[model samples]
Target: MRPRLSLPKPHRRGFLTAAAGLLGVSALGGCERFAASPTGRRALKAGEDANMFVQRLLLTPASLAKEFPDSQISPWFKPNGTIDPPDRAYKALAARSFEGFKLRVDGLVERPQDLSLADLRALPARTQTTRHDCVEGWSAIGKWTGVPLAEVLQRAGLKPNARYIVFHCADTMEYAAADENEEAETDKTANPDMEARPEGAENQASDSQAAGSEAPGAEAEEAQGTPIRYYESIDLTDAYHPQTILAYDLNGKALPVSNGAPLRLRVERQLGYKQTKYVMRVEVTEALKGIGEGGGGYWEDRGYEWYAGI
Candidate 1:
């Protein structure tokens, strides 16, 4: 667990600026070497842990991010990252309006849970209008409503050894159509025989195309490797924050597919990247060593900071 939250000092604003440059170069750069080179690594490197430590030490557990008046909300909250996931299992769930979508919770807990959408909605909910600061230098204020994550953690009963909370998402980093062999190999669990397709289907939630991207139905070729689904983590301190929600609604409406339907993490204090979309599961673990090259997030694996404070 991390310390309580508090305000960052003026000197640390430089860290934020440096992080921006780090992110830009990271976008165009190599693998983990961003932190391992002889020269100072642009990514978090040694400073990553220090950043997390300072944030937790300074920030208060009860401190809240700025909330905007509803009038200030954006006309549209632009969606980034994988807009559509073409995974067959996710398609089926979305087709039925995610009636079958289950947010699986396991790892380092007492009672493991498989919570349905309704199950989650039935819990206590909070709605807040807050700014989403994206790493790409964009910001938007929108009202988000969902259950407080701490409530769920209490329900699950965290074990003594539990430390970091891992979020498994449905969004894939590499957007490529699955080849027949790959599809067939996963068919039994992911694409098993079922009723005819629904009117519309998609999690890696939207195959909705990005600029210069191919259509969903474009032939899936023999790519070098499989797509990597997005995942991220945070210490327990952030998880227990009153404003930390697993949001199902944006601006008083159910989140659209592009905005991480049926659920997404809303750690109000962190940058938008930490608010991973298309969340599928949550895992509690002591250390990050065994997960995704041990960097803590998809981008972190590439050299971005695990603690991307605003």
Candidate 2:
């Protein structure tokens, strides 16, 4: 049997405590309100940015996450967030086994371009066995193969002002109005767990209209109080890190829909949530304010830490 890998646990409890204390409440309502309030929002953001600064200042950007040998690979890597994106566009691409899937690279670039899976594969590839740590307190090691994100950023001609790389995904996990976060939904009690979706809620809702198990498509969009866009971002320091990759293969096989087929971001040093799935677009921006809730990530908007640096 393979040993279960885990990050050092000494600080996990302290981190959670400080996070809860910072938000003023452990209950969902208080946490949400505090995170959404202007003063609380600024506090959380400053704390997040400060944490990021400390991580970058203390650790070299190119430092690698510990790598394991092939024998240590997990027998079955648990699919992390938004198993099957049920978006119409995503379905169209998956039908052909992602033969025509194109990753869009835009914003703060001299050239905005879309590259197909073949195009991405043509670039230099790096493979590494790294442990994936989830916020729910679990870890698994898998060998991931992909082109470095820095290579793609270079190809896109990242402008000097590109401060952060935003990952825009296909899941409709939103608490805000469609198109943008202009309006808030009255229902905020659905997900107190901060999971990808409320367990089977999204699956059942989408399956009712979708083609049953044939699609394995998500139900977040159709489900009430679902999460939105499933987005995340990292500053240029982490974005350019050697281990930060756009992975298309996991454990020596083509990535699965449940595991973010076509491509997913793999920032080895951060928590698993920082590595988003069903990545349809990469948008470079000078700031995070325009994205959902302006808190840095989907979970961050709902009270999780933005800088989930582990």
Candidate 3:
């Protein structure tokens, strides 16, 4: 039998207070008239930048979170969004069980790399079992072990303009029609389905469709190939936090493919989505305004606050 571990009462209270305060701030920032106006937008950006800077300054660099005894580990750690990406490229990777998968680190860096699973495993690793809280109102406790993201960044030689870090993933949340159409056409030509397409045939069809939709102009944005895996970005302050890691192992073993096998971002302070899984590329940039509706992330563009600190 495992011991039932719980968070301290004061810590729980503090978490609630911070969440309420953040919600209030987001509510104020979301007012359309205020957020859309030039003056208001500038003011909001300034305020956000200032708040981030202050938080960075106050952060204790080496301070560690409390680690629990093994008996306290939760038995069931629930999987979050897009548990298995519907994207064909991701499915193919899953088929092989992700044995050949590699994580690429490029953009705004002096040294770009295509690191293999073995390469990542060789890096220094940290293990922690922390409580994961989601904005949708659920919580889970799990043990995660991985290399510190700061170490990976240091090895990459980030350029002076690198102020934000963007994570590109193999998973996607939505499937667009444009992507679907391309797949159908490719499948009809490549593999004729007399009775019905085989599972592999269907996947190939989907991949062809996804590939056909990429505009030539879109290709110029990054050297990487497309369907631009589900991506998210964060400012440098969060990027360098001690708790922010490129997790290669989870719960004391090689991470299962369903749990983002090769590498996953564990930005402990933010919401679950911000911790992107099956990360392929880590791009460091100076601004978020040019990335996806200029809000910060896919969810942030929809209405969720970018700074989901809790």
Each prediction's TM-score versus the true structure? 0.75, 0.75, 0.68
Ranked by lDDT, the better of candidates 1 and 2 is 2
How do the candidates rank by lDDT, highest first?
2, 1, 3
lDDT of 2 by residue, 162-229 (tens): 78899998765535555455675633322224435333332233322332333333465444334456
lDDT on C-alpha atoms for all candidate structures: 0.73, 0.74, 0.63
- Per-residue lDDT, model 1, residue 178, is 57
Candidate 3 per-residue lDDT, tens place, 1-310, comes to 1112222223444444455544555778457776677755555555544444444445554444455677777665555454445455555665566778878898888889888777877888778887777776767677899888887888888787677888877664433335434431212211111122222322232332422332223333222223334578876656777788898777786665445656789988777768777788888777887776677776777655677665
lDDT of 1: 0.73
Worst 10-residue lDDT window for candidate 3 reads 185-194
Tell me, by lDDT, which candidate is best: 2
Stretches of model 3 off by over 4 angstroms after superposition: 1-58, 61-63, 176-228
Query: Which is superior by TM-score, 2 or 3?
Result: 2
